[model samples]
Target: MKSIGSKWMVVLFVAVGVFMLFNGRAQAAYPEKPITLMVPFEAGGGVDGFARALASRMEKDLGVPVVVSNEKGSGGRRGSIALFKSAPDGYTIGFPHIATLIYDDTLGETKSPVDYSKYAVILRVDTATFFMYVDKKQPFKSVKDMKSAGQALKFASTGIGTPSWLIPSAVGSAAGFRTSFVSGHKNLAEAALAVARGDVVGGTGSYTHFRGVIDDVRPLVYMSDKKSYHLPDVPTIADLGFGKLSTLGVPWVIVGPPGTPEDKLEKLRGVLRKIIQQDEFKKWGLENGYEPDIMPPDVFWKKMGELKEVYLGLKPQMQEKK
Candidate 1:
């Protein structure tokens, strides 16, 4: 009886040991399969282009295929929610704008499908500066001229609540201009083409995204205080009059679903850091008109917190949409 009892205990111990080993091996062998990268915008847009490029490089570093899935709607909220709802395994991740991530809660837009706190921030990949462009045929050469005209100008944005919309709205409110906003485009390309054709007098969004259409439209001013590297000749809003109203470049962030293991998150972050630092990635980003402003997880989180405060302060002005 004593020998039988001892034998039973030995079997149980071996089973427990085997289970622990398997668990550790599973945890360490993260991203064993192809990873899905969700892009919350339509394909062929600037964000989509950037996501594809980053994914292509990341696959080389990670040794796994990174697939980009386009989930468009609700100003990028639909896909964001989907990404959040996905399993916390490292296989599922998302690339979303910083404004969409921070302002979703404050704007009462939609309950984030993913808990931001649970996800690991891989890195801040890029900052795209929005430009205020007017058709070259328009009489107003500069913002001062347009402001002095005092007539309401028609402006087109990607949508009502997007940064492309909000930045122009903020500028209009601060500069005390009667600006009318028209929505309906999926991204800046359509709106930019509309502005270039004189369907809309002005447009706003990343200058790089619109650089291809600059021949038809002339940039009036930058939305931010600092000048844009892509359009260095153009003056910034601060260079005009509305110093307090100037905004910064929108940051692009890569995040995994909540409950992703720390080690897995660190692995993603490590690959991203390496990719961002690579000369090929940097050159490609610059050539495509993106600034390589990579930030680590801790710093990126702090910036997200700060940007939330800034967006909240602008919420009141955002209500008075024309």
Candidate 2:
């Protein structure tokens, strides 16, 4: 009887030891080593630059080195899908354009077949104002003039569902102007160049993105109610008598895969909030012509939900291509 009891006790001890091992592993703190931040766009673009700058600062705040990895393809669907499939232990996160993640899900652009709601919201970093620009040789000086031209003007975009496309579509609807779209470009630089060379009449993009090329083109009007910092002299769409049609604010968000622990998510948000408030980060954003609009995790999530609704309402129009 004593020998039988000893065998049973050994088995029980081993089971307890194994259970503790896994429990400890599960409870282990996030970012035990270097963390990877995935950028869905190609390197050297505005979004990629923002990710790199923010990641550099976040590394200091988190006390861990943050590495940026580019996974470009399929209108940013490839990187986002990979992010979703990654382990939710907070080691991997994605900096995805809000429109691509929220609107594309409804449009069937992403192949991962996962819903946007599955991701954990971290923080909203900044929102940029978009501008419409035409070549200097164009006869139109303002949006009204451009509309009166009474011809379908060709426009270029980075791709469908990007801000480069949505801003133009929104302005076209509001201004009663027809635009022809040429897509499948690898980056915004190519789209901007296409507009400059008159391959297209104009293109819509952030004022910051066209800083160097502003001299080659004429700024028609900003899509937002407020004038852009980069183009303070330019009139807004509201200034052009299109106040009701003016709606332009694209948020840069940080998100982790779904199923991440609440505590871990909160930790990441807390660190990001601290980093965003830093004077250096704010200065960098201001210099780059971006508005620093930071929000708490919960508020950010609520705002995303609201924007999702807005995008859903515009789905029909967005689906219609020129």
Please name the candidate that would achieve the greatest TM-score relative to the true structure.
1
lDDT by residue (tens digit), candidate 1, 1-322: 9999999999999999999999989887777899999988889988788889988988887888999999998778778778878888889998765476566666645655555655567777876678887888899887767777657788887676677777777777776676787788878888888888889888887866687788999888787778777778898888878665554457788888777877888898888888888898888888987777788878877766776776778777777763
Lowest-scoring 10 consecutive residues by lDDT in candidate 2?
103-112
TM, every model: 0.88, 0.84
Model 2 agreement with the true structure over 214-298: per-residue lDDT tens digits: 7788888887777777678999888978664454456677888888777778878888888788898888877876667787667
Distance from true location, Cα of 317 in model 1, Å: 2.6
- lDDT to native, each model: 0.78, 0.76
Candidate 2, pairs of clashing residues: none
Each prediction's number of clashing residue pairs:
0, 0
lDDT: which candidate is best? 1
Candidate 2 runs further than 4 Å off: 1-29, 105-112, 241-248, 315-322
